[model samples]
Target: MPIRLATTADLPAISAIYAFARTQMAKDNNPTQWGKSHPPLDLLKADITAKHLYVIEEAGNIGGVFAFILGEDPTYQQIDGAWLNDQPYGTIHRIAGNGKIKGTFSKALAFCEQLEPNIRIDTHQNNKRMQHLLEKNGFTYCGIILTEEQAPRLAYQK
Candidate 1:
């Protein structure tokens, strides 16, 4: 699989992957993380333009999307619990699978690890799947942190 920077032309597939993610999150009882208007096209366009958005192609198709931001994440500055280290980190946000593909997080993590080992990620308290994926992939819980929207999320670091 090759992970590449996302472009405007990839919006349709990215939107579809996120739609599947929202539905799955709802079904898993984590309805508050992403709402109906979340990850809006405009926001994605901004990510693409900012060079933060990435897409992973698997088996000749776009199978995953995520935003990898380097540096201190403002929302993570106030975690209730301490981080494992005070080193610089990269934050992985808005990771979503293609619905038809498995191990999307694994692929994204592998890609991120190649660039930076000290990584951070967060998920809704109710997103058990993601929590498991994080833990299974070597992330340690760092307690709750609030998003810019004032929503509390379970933070983790690796």
Candidate 2:
């Protein structure tokens, strides 16, 4: 699968993927992470406009979407646990995949690594699947970081 920068044309498919992901998360016991609408349309549009959104395409179909922003994330400014390093890193956010695809996380991580070796991510405490994937991919649990909403997330870095 090849990852490409998302365009406004990709909005519909991206929205669908996220919608499915939200349902899946709820079923997986992580309902509150995204709630009804995690990554709002306007924010996703902003991500696309900023060239920070990417999608995994397979056979002309979009299977996954994510935001890879290179730089510090304001939410990560403070942590109850220390980061692995102080090196410049990229943050992976709003990563979601349609249930039809496997290895979406691995593929996305590889793509981000090509741009920057150090990567940071966060997940709601109940997001066990994501926690497992991140740990399996060598992402160390850095600590608790609060979202803009003041909700604490489990932060990880690689």
Q: Give the candidate number with the greatest TM-score.
A: 2
Model 2's lDDT to the true fold?
A: 0.97
Runs off by more than 4 Å, candidate 2: none
Q: Largest lDDT belongs to which candidate? A: 2
Cα lDDT of model 2 by residue, 1-158, tens digit: 98999999999999999999999999999999999988999999999999999999989999999999999999999999999999999999999999899999999999999999999999999999999999999999989999999999999999
lDDT of 1 by residue, 60-134 (tens): 799999999889999998989989999999999999997887888999999998888899999999999999999
Superposed by TM-score, candidate 1 places the C-alpha of residue 151 at a distance from the truth, in angstroms, of 0.9
TM-score per candidate, in order? 0.97, 0.99
Q: Which stretches in model 1 have alpha-carbon errors above 4 Å?
A: none
